[model samples]
Target: MDNTANPAFDVTKRLRATSPKSVAIHEEAARVMAAEIVGTVEIACPVYIESASGSRLTDVDGKEYIDLTMGFGPHVLGHRPASVEKALAEQITRGWHWGIHNPLQHRLGELLLEAAPCGEQVVFCNTGTEATMYAIRAARAFTGKSVVAVFDGSYHGVHDYALLVAERSSDRRNPAPRRRGAGIPSEILETVAMLPYNDEAAFDIIRENRDRLAAVLVEPVQSSNPRTDIGPWLRELAKVCREAGVLLIVDEVITGFRLAYGGGQEYFDVDADLATYGKALGGGLPIGAVAGRTDVMSVFNTGSERARPIFSGGTFSGNPLTMAAGIAALTEMRDTPDLYPRLNGLGDRLAEAINRHARQHKMPVTMMNAGSMFHLRFAEGQIRSSRDITSRYVKAEHVFYQHLQECGVLVPGIHLAFVSAAHSEADIDAVAAAVTASLDTLRNDGMI
Candidate 1:
């Protein structure tokens, strides 16, 4: 094989000259920062972004690229949307942070409750991690149960209980829980159960563990394995949870607002006892919340005697800046009836075009999407669940994304991409073209 044909080698050479500023910045940081920070696949190019606006990003080196990550699911309205920006600017003048009560929280909470099917009340927090942690705590306190069940391939947050993966050697239908990373105690394994995604066998597990289970947390669309045909499965899961007397906590961190105004609850037509939200909720700002039935959420209320009050507070939980942004974003989305339809249509068209191209050329790649959320899979077959994925084309997959970057398109390290309302038809066209060119380049180089 010719060395020049390797995309990684070519990418390195091109970036070194065109992105000298970014390379220098990365070098400086590498000397002081932890090795793990600078070595992630997400930052593969060391291309530091200088500014972003409306589906495009400019790097410090003055090169521009179309951004598909969309702030990893937060910037659904695109970066620096006028309404959110205006709200933030005005909020800054009034003092962005105050440790006291502010009327902004009331309006934001009202908007959330109105949109979320299960949301009667909301509790604010700093990030999705905190929101899930608090939701789990409340579920346990409310039910007096010791266990929380999570599905395989579902990512909730960085908390100890949320960082579980199914043991690879265990049975696919009945998998054992394993810690994803270090620092998580082995004892946490006892408090959590891992279930297969998109499988009816999970229903049996829920029933068997009903006595000890407090809540069954799930992501409507798994980030690692996105699919559009999971509505039936989700609806059935909700029914099972109800039958077993276990609370269902849908982790809408990635799907909230992006799928629809009501998030996964409306998209999948399922109700939850408790639902956690983040990502798009704050209009590109850092925020998280748990919204649920009044009875279950009342566990946070000290005045309620139904259950012991669970401690939930944060210094910046309901900061005025985030509240202003959330209200502005939600208000625009609610008023604009056609926004979701247009966004979802764009997603459908993009997926169709790329998948058609792959089929016509016999490429072993598939673009799976759920509304605007997308994931590029290396295999070309029906993917019912994350366990069906194979790592045979891992090297080619990395090279394909590198080639995409060379063509002025950007996707995150995990290959989970999203489209926003700000992405025009022309923008989608360009993305489709870039994907085709990348696949062709990979084929020519004998990488795919």
Candidate 2:
């Protein structure tokens, strides 16, 4: 286990030695910032990015890296896309925010409704968190029900009601809901139900809870468990929701605009009663939206005769800058017939390369992808759900990423990565090589 003898390990050591600026800044940030970093996993080497272009990022130390994070799923066209940048520049000249109604929202709403299969009306919000929060409220208002059901291993957002997670000790087939973090009221758990993902038992649970459930919120592809073969499961879930009279809210925060121009609903051909979108919706800016059937969306109408119309609005809900960027991005996507196919093909190629290497070399890892979205699982065998992730090679996984960083590639601490239209065949080749080398390094160190 003499790591210094390995070339990959030596490269990582050199990288660490050269990144004194990032280390110094991280120390300073740790003292002032509440969290050392924004993500769940701690990066092996801290890197403070100074700027980003197409498929690459330059750190404060002027070290370049092939960026696979892609702004955590927003940059479908890659960083600072010219069209979005131009739209943003134009909007800035006209005024970025007005705190009042603007005409730009009209075209954006029309585009969203046209693309979303279930959309007849649309509402805007600031982030995916707010979008899901409002979608739940709208479902409750329309159905006169109090409880909402969410699948285990799915992330809705950061709100208190959206923070429920399945207890680890609970049955995989019949998960018990628990709060994810502190300060969430115990009462919040009463209104949320957690069901197992990609399981038939969820149908029976939905049927049993039909009377109390207002909606069943799900990510068409769970971020924690990214699998492409769940189309039938999603379609069945939609059917069950309809039969049970529960509104189906597809949380497309990560998949929207990235999976397809119309997002998960269009990609999977599953109709949702309400769909929450964010991430790629604003091109590269911050935005979120809820689109659904007119009946369910009518809960937002202030003029409605309903006793209490749902209140959902933000000061920057449909600001001009975001709307302009969204229009440009969506228009570009719509005009470019081959964009989705190309991006998805790249994702498939990358996944195939990585998985093929792992299988041939007997590495304890696999890569799963749904269209352009990808996640690296550090365990072998079928991973149908998050519960299946039980790899004992924790040290190996960490070291593999560290080696990848040394090879000039950057994957986010969370292992959920993405490929964009900006990434070329050469970028994919580089990533594949990095992954192969990282695995070899882990083996050399006897970590795997």
Candidate 3:
């Protein structure tokens, strides 16, 4: 463990325990999870949701919350959406799993291809983690390079390569891959090269490793706390990957569909060799997909001798129920012509309002946004790379979240939030007001 990250505050020591439903559930989780799991020690505000609807949640204590977490950005159409609900109903009437190819998977795949401009072929999977794992393997098979590079602070689920984070040092010379947890093998980290997100130096990193690099995977935008738009950098990444003969893979698991119907590709205006999607595309079901140009994607084509070793065998890969839900979700996002612009406007308003409130109250916090994606950072400088997101960014007056939760609003697990098509002007206003209230209370207590 790095002493730099082991700041006095990031280390969590409970002052006391309680019997609240949220506390009880967390206690149980602590008991079941290994001590090595960060969740077992580090803590956040409470949430014991009993039920959720469009953009709102009700906890077991009967308190309502305007849900900005949106189940980690998956419920873009909002929780328990009628379209997905109806689709699940239809699937229930038909069947669950058949352990073979089904029509629904074919239909959803076609739908994904149609929505996906850079995509010529598609492969279904159960989760974003699986989608990324297979996509990297596919890129390696096609390009014959053993190494892949992912940006720092970019979340790519649980994978050996993406688990690495940049070393906590300002000097470029000190940069090294730091493992996420203790058990990840050093050999695995050796295969991966870490780059600072949105840094111009990415060109240097890729150029230096061009011979060994199979792919350069990136999130078009790092939407975690303090959302930073990486549009121009994405264009550069696309250009470099083509010139270097290294495949570019966009890990759009979080940004897909929420930002635009076609995901990060549509927003960034640069085509990657492959893109992975899960969150909003699944429409509340457990689904993920990797799509790419036929040349690179054909490695997965059935009956191809070259494709035999690139295995992605998940029993729930193309389950009918999940396909049904995805079909409905994609259709909703596509059919509604105005949803994209409308959600973007609301997100803009939310960011603007939150920033205004934070500034007026002398809180050194800033909210940023890209379409419906938004997050806050406590740092005052320009956030360009993953290294820029320091402890000051996350270790803000978290009592704001606690107060917001009390006042019926839910942000992300950290300093993040998302807007959905289900969010309306009133909903946005309510969240804005909650932000003001939370800040006001903090200011009164001399905490801001």
Candidate 4:
């Protein structure tokens, strides 16, 4: 294979020259930063973003690309949306943080309860990791059990308990927790019981572990394995958790406002005992929350001697800025009831176009989606679980991502793409075309 003819390889060379500033910044970051990037180890390239607006990101090199990652599934309204910006601007005049009772938090909480099917009352936090962490703690306090059940390949957050159980796959009916990385204790890993995703047989595993389990934590639609037809399985899972007397904790960090105004619970036609939310809830700001039935959620209420409260407070939990931005975003979503369907239609169009292009080129890659969220896999056949995503495809997928970057499309390191309300039909079509071109380049270089 001629390396010079490789489009992604050529992109690397061109970017080295065009992105001198970003390259220097990355070199400086690498000196002090533990990892090459700030967030995850899934660093695609050293491209540094200077500004973002609508569906486009401008790199430090001044090259603009159509972004589909959407801030890793939070920019439902797209980057720097006008509504969110306006709210933030107004809030700038008020205050940044108040270590006291803020009225905006109460109003936002009311909006969440009104929209969310599972939300009766809510507790605020900074991120999804905090939300899920507190949700599990609340469940343990309520049920007086120690064990928590989570499915394989479902990412809850960066917390220790949620870490080991996510982003891995096994065929076992009852898989043991696999540590995500070093530093998390074996004792914390043991507290989590793993189940197979999208498999009906998981009900049996739940039945066996019901006595020791305090709650079953799950993502209604696994972001790692994006799919739209898992409603039946999720409904069944909810029923099993209910019958087993285990609290059902739905982690909607990725799917919350992105799926619908009401989120996963509404979209799946099932109710959870407790639901954790983040991502788009604060528009582009950082925020998270745990919402659920009043009875089950009352474990956090510490008013009397009889009340046993779980400590879930944060200094920045209910900051007024996040609340204002959240209200603006949710109000816009509520007013425009068609936003979810419209964005979903665009996503479906993009997925269909990519699949059609792949078939035309005889590429084996499979593109799967759930509403605005999508993933590309190098495997053949249906991918029901994260285990089904073959390791053989990892290199090809990484190359494909680089090729897409070369073609002026940005997807996250997790290989997940998101379509936002800002993405027009023209943008989707252009992305599909870019995919075809990128694959053609890959085929020419014998990379596919």
lDDT of 2 at 172: 94
Highest-TM-score candidate: 1
Q: In angstroms, how far off is 137's CA in candidate 3?
A: 0.6
- State the number of backbone clashes in model 3: 0
Residues 1-448 of candidate 1 have per-residue lDDT tens digits of 8868556778667767777898888889879877644233453567778999999999898889999988888988888899999999999999989979899998999999998999999999989999999999999998999899999889999899999998778999998889998999999999999999999999999999899999999998899888878889899999999999999999998988989999988999997999999989988888999999988899999988864599989999999999999999999989999989999988888899899999999989889998899998889588877877888898888778877887898888767899998899999999999999889888887877
lDDT of 4 at 395: 58
* Candidate lDDT (C-alpha), each: 0.89, 0.89, 0.77, 0.85
Question: lDDT score of model 1?
Answer: 0.89
Model 3, poorest ten-residue lDDT window?
Answer: 10-19
lDDT by residue (tens digit), candidate 2, 240-272: 999999999999989888888888888899989
- Which pairs of residues clash in candidate 1, taking residues 3 or more apart in a chain or in different chains? none
Full-model lDDT, candidate 2: 0.89
Please estimate how well model 4 matches the true structure, expressed as its whole-model Cα lDDT.
0.85
Off by over 4 Å in 1: 1-7, 35-43
Off by over 4 Å in 3: 1-19, 25-45, 170-174, 225-229, 305-308, 392-395
Cα lDDT tens digits, model 4, 311-420, are 76889998999999999998898899789999889989988988988887788777898889998778777677877767775656667767777778888777778999
